[model samples]
Target: MAYQTFRQEYLQVPPVTRAYTTACVLTTAAVQLELITPFQLYFNPELIFKHFQIWRLITNYLFFGPVGFNFLFNMIFLYRYCRMLEEGSFRGRTADFVFMFLFGGLLMTLFGLFVNLVFLGQAFTIMLVYVWSRRNPYVRMNFFGLLIFQAPFLPWVLMGFSLLLGNSIIVDLLGIAVGHIYFFLEDVFPNQPGGGRLLRTPSVLKAIFDTPEDDPNYNPLPEERPGGFAWGEGQRLGG
Candidate 1:
């Protein structure tokens, strides 16, 4: 896909992207207040148990440590991936991407809370991002000027390293399993026309969902007003 064309086609940034970035900013503020700690929410059973807050599932993504480099690196990675996805599927329809990202994170968190309670704090976000990157592996990136492959298998390498470093391999495995299941489900119950055909044009939404389609919405430009332009063109100059 032509990156320039894709970028040109997108007139506006997706709402979900804006919302996510805003949340990250807010998290940074909260962290500075010392009112909350990112790591505490992840591994502390007491914090989770006492607070009993459900928002942690989603808020956890926004939590970055005080380490400026780590936080910047994560934000850059997220921006690159999200921009590629948003541009690739034009019309700024980010509903599905947002849904999948959050849903994947939620699933990972729940799995951590239950199956791998020991690594709850250590492995949630990384696993979720790994799974997402795996499923959408065709999206490539250049690492340090060297062409590095991503999308399908690179996630495993990351997961392996995380395991070697003594992080929760179990949560990573669970993420991979869930990602595969999501892929299979999409293949089976495919999105069809007649679903949200007006506001978004069902074909656009289908592409956003990454569903296979017999016909695709390739008209990247907005539709022209019927006969309106022709009438204007035919009129005498300055009349």
Candidate 2:
């Protein structure tokens, strides 16, 4: 019964979020078990270009190191915000959401080339949180009941928390920059006078990822449901 319940909940997560979180967990587990090493997963431009270790480009974003406080903290935020974005503003828009992921990821990769940063999973999570917060600006949020503010401040609050932990703020800042660029181009500028929709969902992508409406019984799930408000003060660290 417990396994079945867990299966049900797992199936409820949207496809992209489900795949991403699964990959993260599996990658971390592999590292923890000594099956893989961080040296293999970090972003190395020379290795990628010269040695053809191209997998580093994607693997760098999948690892958060062995299980610990940072790993658990990042995973929670990633799962929560990524799921929320998939189920909220991006609802019924799978192709566009996936495009956003690709876009943000490409930008991050470009920026990372110049920075001495590895393991972009934390920054990726921050980007997701930033985009979600921007879209839902009015949503009231609190961090561990100690800090309460609007949704958009969540990313900055997280940056401050990272600072407190003796971690560098560059990753968090990189994420915020990418997220704001996305928001400005896709959401903000497109609505301004003389502005147009520059980020049209490609026809091929729509054809591949979007659901067809011609089918009368193409239910994708137990029915479309909203994500839970799992954020706020009561939630414990590493939860």
Candidate 3:
């Protein structure tokens, strides 16, 4: 009975978020069970280019280390913001969302070649949080019930939390940079004077994942509010 209930809820998540989060969890589980090792997953330029271990490009963003506090923390933020982006502005635009994932992942891989970092799951999670926070700028956030700030400050708060934990802030910075690049190109630039569409999703991606916007029966998810709150009313969260 519990399994059936779980299946129903899982099916209801927006498709992109559902698939990505499931992959992350399963990858971690694979490591936990020792079916694979982090050594096989971490990003390595030589392995990817010279040895052609192409899978590392994707795997480096999946495993978040063994299950514990750090794992749970990153997973919570990842699932929350990823789902929010999918169900909010990205509703009915699965192909574009997938493209954003591809863009961010590729950009991070390019950056990883020069950096000493290994696993990139946490950085990817920060990118999602950054993008979501920007789109829902008016939303209010409560950090562990101690600090209350508007949504725009969320990525920084996460970075600060990372500092408190003694982890490097470089990963968070990388996510922020990529997230900003995406947000600016997609949301900001097109609206500026003389700026036209720049980051359009390719026709092939649209053909594969998006129903034509003009379809007579086409429907988008209903009653979406930025950050899950009405634009005027805004949002308040303890997440």
Give me the displacement of residue 37 in model 1, in angstroms. Answer: 3.2
Deviation in Å, model 3, residue 224 alpha carbon: 8.1
State the lDDT of candidate 1 residue by residue for 69-117, as single tens digits.
Answer: 5466455544433544444433344556655565566666656666735
Sort by lDDT, best first. 3, 2, 1
Which pairs of residues have clashing backbones in candidate 2?
A: 144-233, 145-233
Question: Between 1 and 2, whose lDDT is larger?
Answer: 2
lDDT (Cα atoms) of all candidates against the true structure: 0.49, 0.82, 0.83
For model 3, residues 51-117, the per-residue Cα lDDT tens digits are 9999999999999889998998888778777887887788778899999999999889889888888
Off by over 4 Å in 1: 1-12, 43-51, 90-92, 115-141, 145-147, 160-175, 187-239
Residues 1-239 of candidate 2: C-alpha lDDT, one tens digit per residue: 99999997898788898999999999989988899999999999899999999999899999987798889888888887788788777777889989998898999999999888987888999999899888876666667657767777889998999999899999999999999999999999989999977878788889988885424443343111212434432221222
Instruction: Give candidate 2 misplaced runs (Cα > 4 Å).
Output: 213-239
User: Could you tell me how far off, in angstroms, the CA of residue 134 lies in candidate 1 after the best superposition?
Assistant: 5.6
Clashes of 3: 0
In angstroms, the error of model 2 at 76 is 0.7
- Model 1 worst lDDT window (10 residues): 223-232
| Root-mean-square deviation of Cα positions for candidate 2 versus the true structure, in angstroms | 4.7
